[model samples]
Target: MRIQWIVSIVSNLVSMGLLVIVMGQYQVLNIQKQREEKLKTEVQRLANEYANDDLSKVTMEKLLADGNKTMTELEAAMAKLSPELEKKRKDVDACQAEKVRSFFQFPKIITLTRQCLFSIFYPIHTNMND
Candidate 1:
């Protein structure tokens, strides 16, 4: 009878330990399921936000077509005005060169003016008496 009582006590303890382990596993699985649900909700929200954006409404092909049209128009304008632009650039360069030449010739111009004034004031006497 004593042996039977000992065996019964050990069996009861083993059953309680298994029950505790099963409860722990159930709690872990419940937490994991909650985290997965939260991730799914976040993904859904991001997808909805992207779908509602203005850029998403415009198609890629349409955007490319508009860009190509603008580029072609700009190229045509540049081709039409290329010769005029080159002529204006040449005029600007000629003006700049003339400005530099005038600056360098300023001293020579003053010296020539002085020589002309002296020659006019001191005329050489052709008659020695008068």
Candidate 2:
């Protein structure tokens, strides 16, 4: 009877050890599954962020293209009007020169009145005319 009792106790201890090992393996497998799920979620979030970045880049590229097109059109328009603008600028310069000559030839009273009116309306203070 004593031998039989010893044998039964040994068998129970062996079974308990096996159960502990199995439970440890199950816990490890559960932790691995949780880690895998976390990594998958992170990957999805990063994918969404990258997708938004790509959309922003595309929008910026389109805006840049439109801006460049507008700049080109403006440059072409300026080019077409450059000669006319230059001629007008030269005519204004010649008229201003004639006015300066006439102002010097005029009497002091007329010169002062013209200068005051020119100063009030045009506001260009050239040292030669001042």
Q: Please provide TM-scores, in order, for all candidate models, with all chains considered together.
A: 0.49, 0.65
Error of 2 at 53 (Å): 3.2
Stretches of candidate 1 off by over 4 Å are: 1-36, 49-54, 57-66, 121-130
For each of the candidates, give the backbone clash count: 0, 0
How high a TM-score does candidate 2 get? 0.65
* Candidate models: Cα lDDT each: 0.90, 0.94
Window of ten residues with lowest summed lDDT in model 1: 121-130
Regions of model 2 farther than 4 Å from truth: 108-130
lDDT of 2 by residue, 6-124 (tens): 99999999999999999999999999999999999999999999999999999999999999999999999999999999999999999999999888778987878988899876755
Q: Compared with the true structure, what per-residue lDDT tens digits does model 1 show for residues 1-130?
A: 9999999999989989999999999999999999999999999998888887645556766888899999999999999999999999999999999999999999999999999987876575434446
- Model 2 accuracy (lDDT, Cα): 0.94
